[model samples]
Target chain A: MRHISHTDINYADLFADFRDPNSGAVVMFSGEVRDNNKGKAVTHLEYEAYEPMAEKMIDEILNAALEKWPLNKAICVHRVGPIDVCGCAVVVITSSAHRAAAYEANRYIIDRVKYEAPIWKHEFFTDGTSEWGQNCDCSSPSHPHHHEHKHHHAE
Target chain B: METTIQVTCFAGLRKFFNCPLTINLKLPTAYEDVLLEMKKVNPEASEILDSCRIAVCESFVPRTALMTSDEPLFIIPPSSGG
Candidate 1:
């Protein structure tokens, strides 16, 4: 499956594909757009992606996860364009014979995709002002400066 | 002869430059040369350019990496997609 989507993501349709009889565990993660960020009242978000590169990078992340973990299936879908508050922005699913591999691989894929994918988010606020969303502050050691100067989100 | 590299900008760089930009440089141009040319066109973009990463042929390349004309370049600012 392709990594990026321009329309709203249907979680049910995505989850239906993971019906592997041999797989004992399926882990899914959905990153939704919240109504607030950094103390600002966010109205919505517009996501843009360098489509070709973003697809390639997400594919690489999924492939690497499959190689690192014994999995039955792995898939990720990220939405672009305008997304309303509470809208699903991205989703990652991994199925394996055990829960540990499924859980670990799901986390790895989401984290890597967030840092490595060439997708940008533009945030619109209630005060009639907007700004480009800062990239995540948790920088990978390999590309420590990639997210330089961005504010860290306290999870 | 001069070589033209078409650069696709994203996020803040796109909004700053208004659109994708093309820069003409001598052959065997390094990634930094493109940024330099961009700075010449839009001096105000220098700060944003400094923090940007250049991607060639779908992969991020170091500033010193040589660029070819056929491969469309991408100027990626900090990405915030989750």
Candidate 2:
């Protein structure tokens, strides 16, 4: 049960934090800001989150993944504020007794993190314009329907 | 029976609502119900909720996700960070 971090991530420390001798497989998934979005060259990206609620939601997603799979330990870390291009956006580490559970849960957590949490990103393009994938006029409900997403770290 | 629920909203989600972080709402309220009330409070926010997901004590509740459970209901806004 952990959810705290800054833009600077030490996977070495993070992996060491949750790994155990009994755990055979340690799988992690990281979501990052890519240089391109929607066929546009991205210059940078901005992320905004509802901290408390977002944390609560993240915990829920963690629990859902745990219930859906088997694992020795699970950890999720997300970043907030303006992120430079290629920065780590989200991190999910799943340590399980087997490789399959660790791998499966790792993927599940990232997908759920995007769909379940309320964090918005503003993608800045090479043309000096940006678009928010989850932006609204500040009106209407946000259903987690989008499927295509980018991962920061994998395997 | 009605009681008061103290909810602390944050980040992008805060911008979505018209109420302050610490506001009084009826207790025994589900997360979705509060979201509906949130629509009235912030019509701008309601649109976002339509596609959003919620959590009660760290469990993802679908659009059909209800808040009838007891204690600790958090409405998550979209976020991405490491």
Candidate 3:
């Protein structure tokens, strides 16, 4: 399910759909908002998306991952609007016959989603300030190509 | 005839522009022309606009690509999604 949700994400319901007997390995990555970033105390996060393009981009990313790897299934869900600290911002799940494919495909999907999707994150600080978070600095020549993990943790 | 296109802004651009803005340009307008018009509307956003990419019909297009007035353009800043 490549979707943009306005409410909280239900991880249980997302995993319940994966009941393929042929799939022996499943990897899930969940990204949550943290209490601090860059030494600032973050109060919450506001996520916004160009809904149509964001969904289409996610679909493209998942399809690309499926094509690049031997995967049984791939799904991603991202939340928009305001989210509190420790709240789930995004989730990606991939299942395959073996652990390696599942793990690799899961990483590929999340990385592309963060770099390609038309979603933006705005962080609010405890000191009554806020700024737009930049997850990927690919456009910058001095920065590395990899995306900076902003509290993303696997589950 | 003049063509009017609506640009949907997000993140920092949205904070500066407030809402989707409409710009009038020539029939065969390039993506760069949109940026020029945006700069004319608000010079303060020029720095931010320089870092953005324009998407049309759900796909990212190059600066030299001709833009259509029928489809809305999305000004995407560096994505911060997980």
Candidate 4:
């Protein structure tokens, strides 16, 4: 299961669908919005995505993980739009026959989704300034030095 | 026939472009052309996009990748999602 949701993520609803009697292990991961970033106090976070592309890319990430692991179920949910600090932003859940596969696959899905998905973040800082978070780990050859946010001032 | 790529902007770019956006290209276009065009519309976003990545058809493409006008182009600024 994969979705780009605008409403708050319902963890229980997702976990319910993740049940698989054949699987012995289930792993779940949730990422929340924090109140600070790089030493700057944040007011809130606004998330946006190329909705159609974001959903499609998320499926690709899940398919890649399914190929590497013997999994019974895989579910990923990403929330878009304004989220208050400490609100859940994303979740990854995987169920497999063994703990090792479940854990590993869960980690892989989340990491790949973070870098591959067409999702973008706009951080509102307490200083009344906002900036787009750079795609530092997008894993694209075109972004070899994306690790740093390069800014050019208008003359 | 002319091709108009659906260019979706997110986050800061969304605010800048008032997204649900599209760009027209003359048949053959490359990734950099999109960037150049975006810079012309909003110079401030050029710097922000410099730190961003561009994805076509849900995959990140290199600057040199050639795209036709029908393909969907997404200008992805650095992602903060987990």
The candidate with the higher lDDT, 1 or 4, is: 1
Candidate 3 C-alpha lDDT tens digits along A67-110: 98999999999999999999999999899999999998888788
- Name the top DockQ candidate: 3
Cα error, residue B66 of model 2, in Å, equals 13
lDDT, candidate 3, at B74: 82
Q: Residue A144's C-alpha lDDT in candidate 2? A: 33
- The alpha-carbon lDDT assigned to residue B49 of candidate 1 equals 83
lDDT over C-alpha atoms for residue A37 of model 1: 85
Query: In what order do the candidates fall by lDDT, top score first?
Result: 1, 3, 4, 2
For candidate 3 chain B, which ten residues in a row score worst on lDDT?
A: B63-72
Quote fnat for model 2.
0.34
Enumerate clash totals for all models, in the order shown. 0, 41, 0, 3
Candidate 3 residue A36 C-alpha distance from true site, Å: 0.4
For model 3, the local distance difference test gives 0.83
lDDT scores of the candidates, listed in order? 0.84, 0.65, 0.83, 0.77
Write down the TM-score for model 1. Answer: 0.89
lDDT for each residue of candidate 2 in A21-125, tens digit (9 for 90 to 100) = 889999878787788976999988777766666677678778887898888888888876677787887788999888999998887777667654667676789
**Segments of candidate 3 deviating more than 4 angstroms:** A139-155, B68-70
Q: Label model 1 with its docking quality class.
A: medium
- CA lDDT, candidate 4, residue A67: 94
Q: For every model shown, what is its TM-score relative to the native structure?
A: 0.89, 0.62, 0.89, 0.78
- Listed models, DockQ each: 0.54, 0.23, 0.56, 0.47
Off by over 4 Å in 1: A138-155, B68-70
